[model samples]
Target: MRHVIALDVGGTAMKAALTGLDGTPLYEERRGTGRERGPEAVVESVLRFAEDLSVLGRERLGTAAEAVGLAVPGIVDAGRGVAVHAVNLGWREVPLRELLGRRLGGVPVALGHDVRAGGLAEGRLGAGRGTGRFLYVSLGTGIAGAIGIDGAVEAGSHGRAGEIGHVVVRPGGPACGCGGRGCLETLASADAVGRAWSAASGDPDADAADCAGAVESGDPVALRVWQEAVDALADGLVAAVTVLDPRVVILGGGLAEAGDTLLAPLRAAVAERLTFQRLPALVPAALGDAAGCLGAGLLARDLLAALAVRT
Candidate 1:
């Protein structure tokens, strides 16, 4: 069977899949990124992970992988196969695709931004399928987005197109890692919600899911915190809708997992705030955690197609 190696590397974990040509998984696995061990170790782990997947494909499926696709966090230069910067992984200007390819016997490698790859999968095979234009917002530890047009996710010039998290939603609200005050992520991301809830509930380990549970049980404190986060999220999303005018906005990540608790209020708030811009249908992500892996497979397939065309 013809197969490709697909990998999605996150802050602490890496999800990988050996996939058939039609995007069906032949093998899937998860492992730590070893980021705590430092950047060099993390890079070594990624290369080893790809090689292991390739070997597994050959042994189990009786075919060598034709290509490899990788989706990684931070600022990425996909066209140049470089991971420009990732604060969590301590990477800067790393030639990931080139390195992985050399380790895999010169097999073709397709590299992309993790969120953009997820958006690609969403546009082709998940919630945004058939939607000509949409925004994929991931409300995880930090917020990020991908602008999907037709079947492709736009990477923008300088590879920072869909960074909605840094958009200032509250003036002088909170400090952001991006050196901005009152950015959307600082107020509304999963990590942000967790921090607020923990401080209010006096549970040092409390997270966003706990906040959602409290909201469901009608806790006044939780409600206040949740509502504040939702309002800020709507502000940032409204800005995106006004500028991009997407047909729909697909929400994913840990915070979005709250389901209706998050979506219901978000929809209402965004609707109330809208003036002349068209309201976008806000929907939950269909693929969940698998979107990035599936998207990596798609990228691999696209690379094969382009190579074949050239020949």
Candidate 2:
């Protein structure tokens, strides 16, 4: 089978992989995205990454690549290959397909939202495998979710679905980057935990990983901060679970790195809240950060299939 290139584009780094049609990675590459310089800089980074992969694929796979699949952070109109907005990267309304397709000699390009693509990976080869209904949540710099049902990722009417982070939780709590106060993300995200811990401890430079380390050392401040974060996250998960009724809830990204430190408390919180409701099994994402690239590759693979039908 021919190969496809999978690239997950973020504000800070890019993860690229060569994957089989069956969604298996044949080879992988990782590099900094360096988007701080602006939109053109990001496009340039992607071009370089793709060029590297094209060379690697030619040498290793011994086959011409089928297409390119790129997943980007922020609001993506994947159907149109556009990056609508990425405030963190100072990018707006980027025509990713046109740029990448041109760079790769007009190879078909599939642009996708990072979270949905990651969820797609879960559906195809990770925790959501074999389950028709699934929700994959990534807890990192911020929180986002993707819903999959019947083996297809759900993109809402305007290419946004499973955006559970903005839901109001405290109503008057901390402010959020999205111009809301007491939003779910303000309370539940890894950044939120770090900020909350820092505020409570009077340490302006503290981060979530520091708090986690503090927990490991039996620090009351970190323990309390972690519990609050877990509770808020469980609240959001309950809402998602109640709405989707997924067979599995897959958590991935930076926060999930805490492993049992996060999973054990999270499981207990969800179980406690679901006393009178159906509970979904909670699982960690198997693909780690590669999930977005893997899913993006599958998007290209699906496009190839669609083209075949038309032909």
Candidate 3:
């Protein structure tokens, strides 16, 4: 079977698949990124993982992968195929595309920002499909965003186009890892909600899911925390909507797993904030965690298409 290797490298784990030309998964697997062991180890693990998948594809399907796609977090220089900086992974200016290409015997490779890759899948195959213009926001350990136009996600001139997380919603609020104060992620990310709930509920282990349950059960403290996060998200989103004017906004990531608990209030909050800007339809991402992996497959397929055109 003709297939491509697709990998989504997350902060903690890597999701990989041998994907068919039509985007169906022929084989799927997961492995820890081993970031705790250090960035070098993580890079080795990723290479080994991809090499293993390629071998597996050859053994099981009687063919080698034609291309590879990698989606990673933090700043990316896609044109250069380098992962510029990922604070979570503690790496700098890694030429992942070149490294992977060598590892895979010079197969073509496409490197992209993880969130942008996910948004690409959303725009073409998930919630934002057929929307023409949309924004994808992920509220996970930290927030990030991707702006989708037509069927593709914009990487900006510097590959930092849709960074809604760093938008300061509250002046002089919590400090952000991006070296900014009061960034939206500081107040509205899943990690932020979990920390606030942990403090309020007096349980150091309480997280955003626990907070959502408490809100459903009518816990006043949880309600307050949820509302605060929602309000901050609304502020940041309004700022984005004002400038971009997307036709739709797709929300994803861990915090979005709370579903309507996060969406209901968030919709109201954003609606209340908007005045002159057109209200874009807010929706949940349809592909869930699989979006990034599927998107990587799409990237590989796109690379193959471009190569064929050149030939």
Off by over 4 Å in 2: none
lDDT (0-100) at residue 240 of candidate 1?
Answer: 100
Note each model's CA RMSD in angstroms.
0.9, 1.8, 0.8
Task: Compose the digit string of candidate 2's lDDT tens values, residues 1-311.
Answer: 47899998887988888888776779888998777677788789888899889878888888768888888888899878889988778778988899889888988888889999999988988889998998999888888899999888999989989888887778888888888887788887888888888888889998888888888888997899999989888988998888888889999988888888889999999999986678888889999987888888988898888888999
Query: How many residue pairs clash in each candidate at the backbone level?
Result: 0, 0, 0
Please provide TM-scores, in order, for all candidate models, with all chains considered together. Answer: 0.98, 0.93, 0.98
Q: Which stretches of candidate 1 lie over 4 Å from their true place?
A: none
Question: Mind giving the per-residue lDDT tens digits that candidate 1 earns over 21-81?
Answer: 9888889999999998999999999999999888888899999999999999999999899
Clashing pairs in 2: none
Our model 2 lands, by Cα RMSD against the true structure, at 1.8
By lDDT rank, best first, the candidates go 1, 3, 2
Q: Lowest summed lDDT over 10 consecutive residues: which window, candidate 2?
A: 33-42
Which residue pairs in candidate 1 collide?
none
